[model samples]
Target: MIDLFHCFGAKPAHRVDTSLAAEMLRASGCRHLAVNTHTIDQVTAGDDLPVGYDTATLGSVMALVGEELALSPVLNINHPTSAAEAVKRTRQAAQLTGIRVIKLEVLDPGFKLSVNAEVVEAARELTADGFEVWPLITPDARTFAQCVELGSTMVRVMGSPIGARRGIEPQHLEPMGEMLVDSPVPVMLDGGIGSTADVEQAFALGFQSVLVNSCLFADGTDPVTALAGFRATVDRVASGTPAAH
Candidate 1:
């Protein structure tokens, strides 16, 4: 069966009440929550969040969410000025929060090939330090190979541009799925997932798991109802029910 990893908390724009999201996810029988720390952006912008919004708070919230649900907080280092800074911040966040799986963002708008080396190095360092490194990169086959070569525990492919509510970009899905099929590490679909149709499409495309954020907290949808619908869709697809064309 395909596992569902819900993005329980996210940046302020996609943020939901962490506790409430967790409760709904648990009730829906969801087993994973990828909380977003957004460290690079927050630290670079010098933004001060409430106590409960901090990395440590994420751990506390996850603990409160109960032991059954595995919580992996996404430690996005999208804005790191240098490779060393990325490694440093990753280590610091892991140390502070005790989160084992660290999700690195290497697909910033300003992404350059030059930074790939740096990101690879940071992944190596994090892995050496006993952290499970999951780099969020563009869905390019070469990039996916590079991440595996760099010791990434898993690869997260963006279904569309991050925070774009337009849903999965159809043209990109097949190619990305092909790349994922050949990846040495597990590949997860992240971002731009807006409905059960999106989830159905993701599974059909061979993604074993998905990370959804905005869809759950979208305006006009009741969060609990939305989650339950997603759970049902996952079940239907897993059970071999045909997706509507």
Candidate 2:
């Protein structure tokens, strides 16, 4: 299942982005819609955004995406935080949105990028709470193994220049796949998953699922058509058919 994520923050680069993304996401064959805890925290204050986003907070967005859309809601607790605090926040999110899986934004946001100890601890705690944890991490052998050891049900691999829309580079794929080949847990590809071809490539490299954004909705790419391709590819891959070239 593809988990397509978007921030849709109070101050997005473009207001149209917030609305356009929401529209595209509804049509996209995404299994889950994810937002970080910070956004959820802001919206709970009862006033922080304009019309398109005013009603699109975490809880409402969760409700807005029903089964017909084939969309589930997920919360990403991405912030500098302790294990206990992260678990508390996740419990709050689960109460609010009924989200199934929680993503630990364990990786810091700045010049230096690495998964700190807090996130690993949080993953352990959340797993102990019987909550599935999806920790976002860069493509690294050691980190990947560590997350696997921590009982991560799935680890979402981030693109370099993380969150900078750079997507995943070609050189990384082979190495990333090699590092993750024998992982017991399924790995979800996060960055540079652009087309049906990308879906095929990711699966070939052992990705059980992927998270896609930017490529489909941005650059005037006709999101509905793009979304349809992804849907078909995911179906084909999941069904054990030969990956469509």
Candidate 3:
């Protein structure tokens, strides 16, 4: 059965803010959270930004998240320009940190098909080393197929532009969902899921999970409440209860 994951990026927000995102998910009764290390500055500075003791710092905080919040933090090794440094961090994240999922945002903006192919090759090397890699990318079936071949544990499909709340554009998803149904590996939907209906749509399409972010926090809707609604909706869809289909 697929599950919901509360998304949290532990940026410079006060410890309180970071804690709040988790607390909100806990209150809403989620068993998992997709924690992130990717921040705007980190993306902008590329690989030279100081990561320092932040690894231990993040790990300590996640370890504190009791049994209820099953944390699967996604460590972003996004900088393609510094593949070596990114790879080092990935090894560190897998070995030292509480991170189990290595979310490789390897595809930098303006990446051509060939560049994406190269990223897949690099990711293949990582997966060969026993790391469960989850490449954060578009919902392209070809890419999904390549990722599966490269040994990714799962694939993440961006539902909209990064954090935009366009609400899982049905047109964009049609092809992605088609791929999910055909692909052997599980697919996780990310970006732009604004409501319970969106969750329902993803589950019905055969996706194993959805990565919801901005919409839950930015809107006045409480994360817990939103989670409850999503959980209920996903359950119904999974059970073949059918949402008036």
lDDT (tens digit, per residue) of candidate 2 on 1-245: 43334433222332333445456565555656665565545445322222223345543443444444665556767554456667787877676656658877554545224364666777778887778888777677777777788788888776544434454677677658766677787787775455667667777777777765555545656655677667677777777888444
lDDT of 3 by residue, 1-245 (tens): 57675554322321234455555556555554443433323433222222221332343445556444664455655444334544666765555454556766554453211234555765777787777787766666777788888889878777766556665666766678678776778788766677777777777777788876556655455656666677677667667785775
Of 1 and 2, the candidate ahead on TM-score is 1
TM-score of 1: 0.77
Is candidate 2 or 3 superior in TM-score?
3
TM-score of each model, paired residue for residue: 0.77, 0.72, 0.73
Taking every candidate in turn, the Cα RMSD to the unseen true structure, in Å, is 4.7, 4.4, 5.6
Which has the higher TM-score value, candidate number 1 or candidate number 3? 1
In order, candidate lDDTs are 0.63, 0.61, 0.59
Where in model 1 is the C-alpha error above 4 Å?
A: 13-15, 38-56, 68-84, 107-121, 243-245
**Rank order (by TM-score, best first):** 1, 3, 2
lDDT of 2: 0.61
